[model samples]
Target chain A: MEALIEEPGTADTTWESRLEAKALIPGTSTGVAFKLWVGGLLLVLLVGIVAYVNQYNNGLYVTGMRDRISWGIYIAAFVFFAGISMAGTLMSAILRITRATWRTPITRVAEAITVMGLITAGVFVIVDMGQPLRLYQMYLNGNWQSPLMWDMMAITVYLTSSVVYLLVPMIPDLAFFRDRLPGRVPHVQSWMYGTLSFGWIENPPQRRALAKAVAILTVLIIPVAVSVHTVLSFVFSTTVRVSWNSTSFGFFFVAGAIFSGVAVLIIVFAIVRRRYHLEEYITERQFTYLGYLLAAMSMIMIYTNATEFITKGFKASDDDLFAFRELFATKFAPLFWFYFFGGLVLPVLIVAFKRTRTITGLVVASSFAVVAMFIERYFIVVAGMSVPLMPYEPSSYMPTATEWAIVAGGFALFMLFLTLFTRLFPIVAIWEMKEEHETRVEVAP
Target chain B: MIVDLRHCDGCQSQGTAPQCTLATIEGHLLPEPMEWIEVYESPLEGGGTQFVPTPCQQCQNPPCVNVCPVAATFSAPEGVVLIDQDRCIGCRMCMAACPYDRRFFNWGSPPVPPEALLADYSMEHQVQAKVGTVTKCDFCVDMVRAGSLPHCVAGCPQGAIYYGDLEEDLATNGKTLVSFKDFTTNNNAYRLKEELGTHPRVWYIPGHGEAVGRDPHTTGRMPTKWPWIERAKGAVTWKR
Candidate 1:
């Protein structure tokens, strides 16, 4: 264990330490359960592909979207995925910048979530397009004045920078896998690790360079993440719709993104910790700390929700009255209340109590949060569109089977990417954990 | 364009659908639920209803044009907001941005008359309707270029609609010609949603159907129709 924890430049590391590190590498000895899980995800992905083909063959008429309610669950899913992508910025970048020692075990999971969430979010945007093939026009005739162009540019930059952020800290770990698991794994896997490791010898100069790169990225990613969500909010706020027109929209959306992001991170952490037998690294202490975050975010969400509603409801213009009716008492009331009580309030209560603050309790709270945030996004899109733009009656929308299938596919794709990432790379940052361990040992009297 | 709401009875007295809506639909070969020029009966503040013949506002500061990611929809030099369906990606950002709800989407293949398929397509006269793109009232720029009134202005039985050139300072509703400035000033004309600063070219002289001797309590108008004898193959229609 001592030899394994030592700097990678040390030549005296024993074969036994390599074998112990090798256990962290998944897919070497695949279990039936893992195979079954992957197979199921792929099967769902296949169904989604078939449904999307049908939607393509037909036009957007197959979906629930119509003239008045031109957007639907697809846009909601896009916002949901984009919102959860804040996980990496919060857990990896912000935590790293702040020197939060306990974040080592979960950074890999959070960063992977960010990348996969963004990729799936991008897919939904394409799926929502009536002329998916004409998407190139966005680049060729792109209007810099459009909020959507800003969104496209922001997401692209965020995705590219996040991939770099995820990969930079993993260089040493990839090098470890490259050297230790060469013949043990497939040649393609071995080659990938070797190529991705970028010829790391882990000398002092290389360490200094890697540290500097990570420090720069760690500082840069937070603003990028915030800007991505803020720009997304501008897509709605810039419009003239009564429900969407708000000066507070940018800040409100960022708060919501981080709220949903932390909830998803907690959920992913719990699953990864149990599934990978990482109890030693991801302890109850991490869960407790994240629970506090979840609780705090829930409070922020409540406050923002109140501010948005109270400000609008107090004014009660003819348009505002109709919008309030639709959200609070009419067609969308059930969804709105579900999100308000079950998604926001219940999580706070779970974390506030001592007995239910255990890992199981927090996971339950987080699950609610995840489902509720999705509902919140749904209402935001659907209810905002439901507000009658004209004097005519408000239009309604319900997701068709095709939309539901495609949404399922998006989620499956997200899970599949995350699952494949875990099989290929260590979900835990081994080097970071080693560094944390070393620091703790040195600090001990 | 000026819509004289005082004379507009929504074609109630004429005992037909709003002539403006019918004429524009027939002229453009528009599909079902796409009334390019719709007659909306809105409630007045004091008591009863008023018939507002609403077409595209032709805003100088068009919100739809501002939000279009591809610049597919743009304000022509004529100050009419026109959509190039060929270039539109059908993201519907413009549709959402349109305050009037005048914009319509061809969700599926639009069911146009077979003859409409033969007409050469242009932004000034949107024909050969494309699937997955937005369409709206183009203010009959094609007819205007030919030195003729728009179908809606010419078709109004009560001469309630007017076509005019602001630069020329002249206006006409087929039978009668008037000075544009004098007509607007005398009638106290106002544009819809002027608070939004869209600076719409279409003006309304607000009133119930009082001048045409139709009661405000007579609320409903005849439902508009597409009047297609034969729709193109594999074409479909959907609700707004």
Candidate 2:
């Protein structure tokens, strides 16, 4: 394994250090952990399936949703997953556009999260839809003018762009795996990886072509990311519903998405970095830098939330006031406060304070922020709907066992994708790291 | 339709003997302003409430029609807005678009009894009420299409609501059939928000003698009948 990693054509010192890092941990045994993880994931999935079956047999009645609170956990899960997926696109686009050197070590991890998050995001939409099978008919006979259509279009574009972005960087690594670890992996894996390499003879033309595709996809993903969040906001804002009827909803949603996305990336990257024994590749500096980035986003997120709440509160329209009261003074008050302080303020404060700027502290803060963002999405969706328009109290929502099971299943699904991805390919973008080493003259991790 | 603002003394004192009021299909008699026909205060050209009793406009180019993604809402050939409940996605896009906010979403199972659900539902009429679909003043298309006056038209004791055929240039308030054009022109009749270009089929002969200016606090509901509904105030109102 050492000899394979330190092959002559690979970049010299960095590859040697990474090989040493891998030796520190017993390789091959992770497959056991993978098995356990997969088993747990399947259990979660089965539980969720049972709950969903119940919901289907009965009506949405099993859920707490009333007419006043039409949206709830499903929409929150959708937003959380969508927000997390933006990490890949934003990171890839930033790295590609600026031609950043140090991004190589973390780009693959980020991109894989994006793909998994997006798949779950798509699934969340189905869970939210009262009529899931009819979701296809949304395509067959869609209203182009509806914001829901725009959401469909943007998410599709984002998914396509992320897959292409992931693939462009995987070509050389697939070739490496094909040649280096033949019998260790399954035959089907070998054939798929071999085919994915597109017959790369380790030649200059193939590298150039792959690089060009990567560059194009990187650039293409940014607008798609922005569009997805914007269209999502439109789904709520296009309505006359007072609280959601703001023009600033797009910017607010996008800022929140990016903030949450960055936090998820930080947490996922930390986990993979530790598990893969890639300490030498992903340095402490990366965490600190990402820490600073997360802090900036947290501040921006705070600003966006303040903007949305203050302006709407001033209007005092019956519906808007009712919405605000529900979120701030009623059933959602605790969650709303928790999201604002725990999700936004605390993370920002921890990163800002000198004492908590260490790598471990940053990781803990990032994880907290991710959880808080999910809470925030839930409050925004469910609480927003809690305000009834007529002479009535807004509806109340409670997720049944089925809803809880599905949510757990979604988390397990995310972990499962990440687990499968790391086992099959180099968690780090090896070729990009090589290029960075050759060009940047940065110190070896 | 005309609303005599002078006569409406706001929501009449609860104990006041009711002169006029609106009753729902369920036989719940509400105050005058709460009637199927609403009298709104309008901007006065000079002075006095420009009382307008708004019934279902039965619009020719209804704003509601353009917003229904599933074609759930369509105008009858005779010019009435109708909803095909079965086809509605419960998205409520039309409810948001209507300037008058006339549409209502059935957020949960309607309060109606199970026996009422046995009737057939059609695009021409709404009978079987479903949970999660929208309902509104459908201009009683089912009745009008059957060569009859709408329920509200027949229910109005003041002859306040007029059903009409624009193509035949005729209209009737059940008591009087008048030439649509001459009646409108002679009465200085108008549709609400003419500049919005909604092309409403319902026309009104403005009343109130001129006390115009919308009182923000005064909703259209007026004082009216039924001791039982008032006595049963604490009972849960149906979701519909």
Candidate 3:
């Protein structure tokens, strides 16, 4: 773990450790925690691979999918991951837009999560497709009239913009990594950092150009993220299906996604801070701000849910009545109420209270909110499709082992991506933290 | 021409082979009918149980077609609604769009014993069915393509359930045939729910005289050879 934070001026002991490393084991906490995290992720990935193979062999029958319930776990997971992605970009953009001084420590990590989250979300879509190999068909023979095409366009654009947004902020950091690391690491590694540094030498002109680019990107990414989820909602909302036909669906989906996204960010950042012992860098103030954000999002989520249900419940036609009864009083009632109370309402109360304002308390509330968001997504999908339109008895669907496996795999993939990410780059934005400190000291002077 | 329900007896003798005008595999036609062409005991401004022989509407602007993503259910250029099983994803979007609740998806491979597979599979006539796809009345497209009247049309002794060319403006039941427009106007015939604009090809003429409120099951024997109709009853199990 000591290697995780390299001591720059230490001499003559670096190359010697590599020779004695075989005999002597390093006792770094970062190394042990990282290994354990990577191992857990691998287990999940294995489950996913097995599930995907089964799906290929047995077709979509492995899922809780019937003709009426054509989409199930895969689509919901895609929506969940996409919602998480919205947090990183939106939170970063908000901070940048407001010119928040305290946003320094968390911004780059959030952007990293954003890029990774969107990529995985896109992967889930392919996994859900009946013909993954023929996925190009959608682009080749895509119907412009269909809302799915709109989703494709929006997600692709968002993914590209997010990668650029993430990388643009890292140019200065890559230069730091290049100079700070010992020489003779690798020619390619040196070349990569050297090239990406764009000849940046901490000059005023260079700093101004990098800052200007990041500011512009931050401004651009907010609308693009909003567009991604709004268009995703359009895939269902544009359909004539009774449950999905509401005008409020787009905003409702977006709000839920943002709420969940912030929750995930809190959890991930908390773990990273704890594992890396980044207490000095990431102070308690960060937790307080995140708690405030969570409280705000929880309120918004509660408002959206009430609006959707109240409006839908008011116009109690036969279809509407059946849908409402299914969600509020029948099989999905438990999940629905759990998401409402535990996911949104409880989290809001905890965050708003004076007693539970600590980092641990906020983490606990945010975790519940994220978990609740997942349950909410599941209920939305299952309840909406489970209601029978005809006078016939409604069909019952239960996801098989294969479906469960893929869901496990998706979560595994998320952890794997994040774990790999930390090893390759700094979890906290090193240059930004230094800059924030420098600026503060200069102001005081 | 209008089916003169008063003069027409329930015994339909003019039907072609494998076709029954008054009775079907499910039930028999009776004077107080309980058959496909059943008369409803509806309170009219005039009051009576009306006899109406219902068949596949063969709509021009079919609702089922518009909602099908896979284009499985579609209207032919000649305006007969049909289902192509090969292309169907079994998504049941067509079943949801159909207001009449006429479409059915095969829950299990249609119960044709192995011997039936000896017959060829044709889009014109679905001889063997696979499970997990939709089925519905195809307006007897097979007979229409062969230049013969539909089985239901030939079976009707009362000159009900006509096969017609909407393009040619001609219609024929076995007993009586007439120009489509002239007969429609002369008989005060009307399509069901014309306001919905489905553009249904099937027209109904109100029952007359003794044929009203007749139960066909009391008078006729239900056919047993075609087991496919018996399986259609299984579709009714999907109700909430």
Can you write out model 2's per-residue Cα lDDT over B1-240, one digit (the tens) per residue? Answer: 322343233333232322323434333222111233444445455543344545556666676676555566777676678876766666555654565545555433334444444556675545544545666666666676678776656655555556776778888878888888887888787776576677776665655422333343433334344344343322223321
**Strongest candidate by TM-score:** 1
User: How well does candidate 3 score on lDDT at residue A223?
Assistant: 88
- Interface RMSD values, listed in order for every candidate: 0.8, 4.8, 6.0
Q: Candidates' TM-scores?
A: 0.96, 0.78, 0.74
Worst 10 residues of 3 chain A by lDDT: A19-28
Q: List clashing residue pairs in candidate 1.
A: none
Write down the C-alpha DockQ for each prediction. Answer: 0.82, 0.13, 0.12
Q: Best candidate per DockQ, number? A: 1
The per-residue C-alpha lDDT of model 3 at residue A158 equals 93
Angstrom error at residue A104, model 3: 2.3
Model 2, position A31: C-alpha lDDT score = 59
Task: Give the C-alpha miss distance for residue A117 in model 3, angstroms.
Answer: 2.1
Q: What's the true lDDT of residue A16 in model 2?
A: 43
lDDT of 3 at B110: 42
Reference contacts reproduced by model 3: 0.01
lDDT of 3 by residue, B177-227 (tens): 688888778877787657667887777665433553344323332232344
Instruction: Give the lDDT ranking, best first.
Output: 1, 2, 3
Candidate 2 lDDT score at position A107: 84
The alpha-carbon lDDT assigned to residue A241 of candidate 1 equals 92
Q: What tens-digit string does per-residue lDDT give for candidate 2 at A1-445? A: 4554454645555654555335323222355666787798888887887877776655455666544455678878988898888888777787568766566678888899899999999987776554455555556666676666678888888888888888878888777766765665568877887898888777888778887887777777888888899888887777656667789989988888888888988888787787776788788877887888899999998888888788878777767777787888888888888888888888888898889988788888888899889988887777766665433334577776768888888888788888778777667777777776665556544
